[model samples]
Target: MNKISRKGFLKIAAAAAMSGVTAGALAACNAASSSTAASSGAAGSYTPGTYTGTAEGISSTVKVTMTFSDSAVTDVVVDTSGETASYGAAAAEELKNQLLNAGSDEIDGVSGSTITSDAVKKAAKSCFAQAKGEATVTSVQLPTGDETDWLGEEPDIDEAAITETVDTDIVIVGAGNGGMFAAAYAAAKGLNFRVIEQNGNVQDTRHWVGAVDGFGAQEQGIKMDRAKLLSEVSRYASGKCDQRVVKTWINESAEMIEFVRSIMEDKYGVKMIYTYGDEAKWPAENAEHNTDYMYPEIEYTYDRSSGAARNELLLQYIQELGYDVDFKTSLAKLEKNSDGRITGIIAQSTEDDHFIRYNANKGVLLACGGFPGNPYMMEQLDPLGTSVTTACSYSPSDKGYGIRAAMWAGANLDKEAAPMLFDRGVVAPGVDGGYVDSDTAFGGKAFPGTIRQYNPGTQPFLKVNRNGERFANESSPYNDIVYAAAHQPGRVYAQICDANILEDAKRFHTIGCSAQTRNAGEAYVQGKMDEAIAAGALFKCDTLEELADKLGFTGEAKDTFLATVDRYNELYDKQNDEDFGKPAYRLSAIRTAPFYGCWLGASLLTTEQGIAINEKGQALDNDNKPMPGLYITGDMSGSFFANNYPCLMAGVAMGRTLTFAMKAVKQMAGLE
Candidate 1:
């Protein structure tokens, strides 16, 4: 690429500005993008029924359903195919609201997200023709700048109101694993730092992380093979994880582990338990709450403790080290100096909504969770994955404020978003206290169910789609039913298990299958699953054919399902699965009188995909260069994993969060 002269650059920028392109991410937009802005027509000019239309989004086609009565837009719903949950989801609702408020489709799109907003408008226009009406369509104003706000517009902040400013060497946002580690290490390094968290207490947050991979476990009698670990990580990440970042994590994890071990075991007297095999794997901490799989090294937990204990202990030590920390302090936004360094951060106190400006002389480290709590973002980011906003595993602090703020400040994001979709949860209704019945669990445009619900029928069973055919391996290597089920037809599937399996799940606590909760996996089994049957969540039948009918399987699909089960049983008897190659010991035939079954919707743990960041934890710009003073860590730096988060290196993200934050601090403090 040739560099343009200053005059040429200014002319081109002027041209873009003249075209109504505001402060938004200006990228290679689809030339064919459309919008439905009407100039001279009234909104109440169409027929009064539901109509469907489609528009292309950045990643996929968006299906929009527009409803009109008396020619006024009454309702607008959307299925944004592959649009990001972080941006498009909110765009859908906001666009709908705009249409309703304006009583027409002529409204301008939201700032920072002109493209997605235009798509919504275009789809609304598609419905106009069906109602015997026409709309004056328009095109989106494509941005020319690399940086844009959430609405895809360039941001212009006014810093006239300083209010308050506290000078600090380091400003850390969110007391998550990354933020906590940054605080500890910065204190240890004698850097003037303060940690700010949106959540008040450690326990109130979603800190239930699992596993921390590293070596030097002689005392715990666990040996780690670094080479094999790296290979496994590469395989699990499917070659998407940056090799530089992976190498750094693998090389430094042992030291991080030693830090944790010294504080956890030797100093704090926290018990470190090491277990072998995948017999009972839930958290890497060996605290089996049912659902088990093979992660021999991962199931290392503190003595009868969990992720919360680990953080609380770290917090204790940080406080003991006399570090300044503030809970319930949210990272509102970042302000950059002319040198492109993050000079200050605007934070809002969650308790009373008081604002404070933290003037950082050195740097600002951002690791404030992901966009799970934002309902629209959960859908837009991982459309193939279900998102019951009520069920995301975090507190109310997971709105992606930090990530979006960084983007607004010129940080780049990974459009190839990879949410952490796992197969460990239950589907409940979106409404308050409304449990999503098993039958209608997977029928939504997005992934269903509350995330990380308590051991919702964890033991892996033979899973089949609505077509009653097997898709992926039921178990092994984290083949999450959440992602699979979301893509399945009707987004619904059944977990078929025999009465014996359900009974065993209840009677004994086994791998990934917990009957501890009274109505859990094994507890709900009976000759007839009356409650779930009434709730349309479960079905029971004496014969396989009858079970199929009760669940609406017919013809070829029914036959294929029966054959799949028969062949599965055959493989079970032979003690070998030649098809998907599921381990024989873990395989169980779906055979038993009066078969027991329940509908399954996958769970959203924590999304690992976030903004793109370089090895030094600096958030990258559109050119893939580090945005000085604007650094990202934890899930906020999303380029680490792609496609899926593998179980191979369980708890590695948590470790990376700490290690990476410390690394960024070191770089800023000139200690590296």
Candidate 2:
């Protein structure tokens, strides 16, 4: 048997064809063993020998050799034929320990390696069966439920089966910003709640690259005006959002921010700093024009602080509250009584494949984030968002599991919210990954390049199709860039920019710059240009025509491309853009002696569509009514933002939603 690495396992498993095994029957195997032991002399007394069994989802084949004498296990040896490296090796070591310790067939499960443990147990069971001269292994009966009824009969409402069970006063799905806050809020109210995270860790990817801006919290005595903050967000959201929701978000934003600040300072002993030079502020002129009649009629204020620190602090606060939080446990199904009232939930731990039925005695809050990880779901939800790669590092488990599980529970589905979109700056191949608002990558130093070169926040640089023809407005907002990228041919690109424009980005690292602008500017300074050139981020040339030729733009289109650059430079000189309404300062002439173009591609972080919930954060059915005993929050509940850009601060919405749900539950229970 050969050893396999963890990376090798993940890479191989991505293409490995898996056959379904009966999880329920296997669960029954545990129960049957316990029952048989009660009826017989001793449950531990079983023959030990080498077993041959096939279990699905194991990265590689495992050979287990065991020796037993006097009805007691003596020694166990485990050799892997092929498996992922670290995880498989860890599991193999754990299996040897368990087999040796049990002294019998009834071995307790190992943590963080539950699924593998089950596989090893099954193989051991096979060995025991063979030693007993059994021709066929007995099948165990598993607990069953109505999956069809849970998912309903409608195609629009996507549903999935509930796999595990947990018992808690409240169950919050998703361990991202919102879900964590929900747990924290519940703890503040003295409620028992459990956060079920599908990922192995909390705040997986959604908040991993986050910059906790837009919250009206005061740090170092610098308080953001809450009303002004609300007004700003409303302007950004384009007045299409629910006013009540927006108001609630604004009003609560400050409290959550302060809450995070307190936790970071007091508990974690981490001083939250206010660094103000990384972002490009909204021009005073544009701010004045867009400030009035903003959709939610609120102003926006942002805290240029570390999103990772904020998230980590908040998670620590939740842990301090004594709430039970489990990671790698996925919600499999929602259980209900005959009256269609949600009674409990079935969840399975990816670690062990063990199902836990969580009885939500109060209510269930679905805070699982959006579904950018699932490509098929993205294409189905927003046909225009298909071309983008999930540029940021996020949770692999955030594949719409909670959304699907909720929809299966007869929840209302919001098709329009299926594909959440976000704008990501192009990272040249040799450069590090795309720039994050916070400096989680790059040692906390802002990327070095001017915003003029890469204004992903505003509009993407001129994107040329395979034939080098420009499509869509190059100066539109990031969302528009995403929409156009999806519609563009071949879904590929080379974004052209010049050195002068890159030099102008150096000012972005100074104080009072927006985090987004700072991130863009720093990309060049952080050796993004050189890195990208080395990594294939840029196609370089001595002349504009040569650059164009390298990019595959030929003939009439090449001439047109040059003409477009000239016209754009003219607009820059004149201080206005007639084509895309871009502000003059953002425009630049592309006639630098040495021209460079970086290949840019579209990507996403979360799915946009999810179960429909009302403004009060109640999970609604297809008829637009609340699902009894169920509430949804976070990305799993739709109708928040049109695209993904921290529409609201993480944890704020979840905090409020769960608080309100807790009150509603109390009222429902006649406790208040």
Candidate 3:
């Protein structure tokens, strides 16, 4: 095995690389050494049967099955379906070959997938133990159903042990969208603020920001009804959200849009355009939108060399204004005064593991994001949301550290979870959606057993569960079908469309980010579908029956699938859906020559539930009282969302994040 040198390990550990490896890495190394010692000379002799061993991977459990002969290992299979498709999953074949060649679990890790590679070696060691007929196997403990608290007790940091101390007007806990906005406005007001980010740079940015009646909307002659918008958002939250926060976004989002335009366009020379401008594409024949949903002209985009450059501009802008962000600094905890008022925070430097105290005279703003990246937090707070997901695209830095710190300081978190789920997780043949055995890394976990995306699922196509029965009104919002499928057998469903997909998708006219595939023309759509088919993420067949069989439908399932297709055709011909009340224009038939099918689960974007805050962006106590020097923004600030994301509003989450970030800065500066 290629073991890292002591110097190399120390260097990486100091840099905080490879998932916060310090004490954990030392423990893991010791465990591996002990396991190897226990199974020292048992490589040649083995029991001649197929043995399976499992370990937690980046997202899901990685299972290694080996068939052994009397003298040599014959066959080896490594299942990394739960990992990132291009990274860990793609490295499975190489890892398997390495294990077989070495005749043991001691093998070099794969490039770009160190976590999954380590997991594979760990699990392979277990298989070696089982082959030797050992009394006890060496394996990491998987989650048991008897677990109580994922969030344990808070840390006790001694003030005397602190290495350094600094005083500032404000302390920002992240450099993401919310943190950047807060920092920009803080610099504009000439506040001596200290911004710290755990990440090396700015996190990935979402493409568009939602607003209402901004300059873009004004130029496009679009005006939205504020009351109706508020009502629609409130309805999406099941009336559990605080309307005061919703109304704050609704009324101030336009101003936020204008302010961002001034900085991004006028100051930074970036051109911003309305997403639903005059050149926007919509179905020509059916021009009206569904009344049950709203597509307000509120989103705007900026031209950039890369997908994230527009957001990164904020950091550059802040730097130019004589403020710098301290990268590789993570929040330790929020400190409070004797009167029970938040005063400042203790932060740990990831570089050398030294603690530094930063006293904030004004307030501390936490924009470190929500807990989508933390499996323990997700499994605890958003069990159902995580249960139905099969993939995650959220930032790894979003581990709910900010929320937890506030909670330790007597902040209340929203009881309900509002996960931003999209219907795009593409799974292979036999994989299903639900929680899986996740890794013990601090980086984060992905939803297991899926690839990047299956964009075709975004269209209002004919969907059938594993039992091959239509289970939902396919014309509903993005996440509705995924949520409905949670009750199905495998917590999954298949989206079946035919050769007329090009024309049908055009007619479907899906709004928001889902429209990218359709707008890219037939060539792009077919290319993506062909790629998915090659990757085994999709199934293509000439007939509906063949497609059903290929998609794992058997016996009654195959019969029900064919029947469901026929019934859907009948609904298409009648131009009405009595079964699910789907709009006739969105109804697609599956009778074309070449048919396509793909099993889908939800792709989690982020969690919107966090420390509860008021309209002023002040972190609230259990009694709904504001904490004196604690503010929250981005996903770290909750009480504004519940259930699922309101996708119909375009980029409302991003809008609310930026809006509240600025609001928090103003309130902390006594301007609000």
Quick one: best TM-score, which candidate? Answer: 3
Name the weakest run of 10 consecutive residues (lDDT summed) in model 3. Answer: 26-35
Candidate 2 lDDT, 1-672, residue by residue in tens: 122111111111111101111121111021111111111224345543333343322333345555443255455666544444555446677777776776444677556545455556655554444434341333321111112211212111012222434567777776676776666666666776788776556664222111223332232233445566555545544543445655554454445445544555555665544332212233333443242211221122223354444445557777676655787676666777898888867666566444567888877777766655433244456545554442543344455556666776788777554343444445443332222222111111122222223232333345555455566555433445555665555454557667554453333121121234445455534464565456544566888888877666678867877876777677768867677665454456677777777656544545645676665667788887878778766666665554444332323334433334333334334445
Error in Å for residue 465 of model 3: 1.0
lDDT of 3 by residue, 1-672 (tens): 222221111211113332532111111211111111111234468666667666545655677876665456667779988777888899999998888788788899798888788768766766665666541322223211012444543455544447789899899888888988889888888888999887678777776889878887788787888888888888999998889988888888888888888888899788886776423433443343344575474688788653436558888888999998998877767899999878898777777667779999999999988877666688888889888898777775566767777887899999999999999887876777865654344433446754566777788899999888999888767889899988998898999998899899878888787887778788888887887788787988888878988999999989998999999999999988889887788898778888999888998889999788888888899999998999998987888889989886788999999889889888888886
Runs in model 1 deviating more than 4 A are 1-157, 203-216, 220-223, 276-299, 304-308, 350-354, 386-396, 425-451, 454-460, 480-487, 502-536, 539-563
Q: What is the TM-score of each candidate against the true structure?
A: 0.66, 0.64, 0.79
**11-126, model 1: which lDDT tens digit per residue?**
11111112221111211111221233322235556556666655544444456666655445556666664665666656766777676676555778777666566656656655
Ranking by lDDT: 3, 1, 2
lDDT of 3: 0.75
Residue 305 in model 3: shift from native, Å?
A: 5.1
lDDT for residue 418 in candidate 1, whole number 0-100: 65
Error of 1 at 36 (Å): 35
RMSD of 3: 9.7
